[model samples]
Target: MTRPLLDQARIHPAALAQIGSYHTDLIAEVEAAVAANKVVVVGMGLNPFPAKARKILDGQGTPYKYLSYGNYFSQWRPRLALKLWSGWATFPLIFVNGTLIGGATDLQKLIASGEFVRLLG
Candidate 1:
């Protein structure tokens, strides 16, 4: 049988510590968000993607935590590892029900297709 979508990507805490570049609190938040039933969106400022993501969650009456790095270049100063971890070069790195469902465009597709609502269930 196929694995559930919510069970797809897991945030390994020890692995994050091994990287040792990001702040402990940030890692803890990421880990916590991944383990929650709600949505989590990590992005930088001045990006439409993150805002778009928040809108989607708002429309569905879903609550999400939005994390930002202020700017794209600022992200590389300390969030390069996070970019590597999420494997996305964009602004919003979204997660839902402990799964990294991807960014705005990806989330939009899911919302449009009605997969997002189903996924949350």
Candidate 2:
């Protein structure tokens, strides 16, 4: 499952460092959460999906760490860095046991299949 990204070699040497460092702090924050928690949900305000994901976790009695960056009106740049870093296009980027399991729908499927608990173990 390879997603197409611009070849790094095609990027000018002068821009590589800048590109690599863009919103690094935000990425680092999410990384830290993912590392420390069994389940981490990276989301933004004003979005129902993240909340939906949380509700699902709650219903299942699953404890998770959530990292919300910004809403529809603010802090889009930091969220963009998260999207680029995770290769997930939407909010509520869910990580289980340090691996990205995708968003709410994906989480639901995992729960339905009883894989979510397995992942936690």
Candidate 3:
């Protein structure tokens, strides 16, 4: 059976840890965004694995919107701390259910193992 769009989006806590943030507000926002039903996200920069990860997610029945890194950063600068730290510069920043879901590599690992698809279902 096919999984629902919202169900396809999931933000694992481990993934969020990859983001370095002393403030909890943005972290909470990321967690909430990524955990949301549709899992809308911005691909902040050029990354090696995001396309593959997106393909895997698409194949597994998850649908997502990819926002340009430049545009995303321009709009979300206040919430993000790229200048203050390295947290904002990371690629493949995922937002589902109002939460953050790490990078492409992590997502790829989860999908390859079948855990992500199963969770989607």
The digit string of per-residue lDDT tens for model 3 on 15-113 reads 546443445565454444555556555554445555665776677677876654344436456335432332435666655444455677767776678
For model 3, where is the 10-residue window of minimal lDDT?
1-10
lDDT of 1: 0.74
- TM-scores for every predicted model: 0.72, 0.97, 0.46
lDDT of each: 0.74, 0.94, 0.54
Cα deviation of 81 in candidate 3 (Å)? 3.5
Where does candidate 1 stray beyond 4 Å? 1-25
Evaluated at residue 82, the lDDT of candidate 3 is 30
| TM-score computed on alpha carbons, candidate 3 | 0.46
Better model by TM-score: candidate 1 vs candidate 3: 1
Q: How close is candidate 1 to the true structure, as a TM-score?
A: 0.72
Error of 3 at 44 (Å): 3.4
Q: Flag the better candidate by lDDT, 1 or 2.
A: 2
For residue 32, model 3's alpha carbon misses the true position, in angstroms, by 8.6
Which candidate number would show the highest lDDT if scored against the true structure? 2
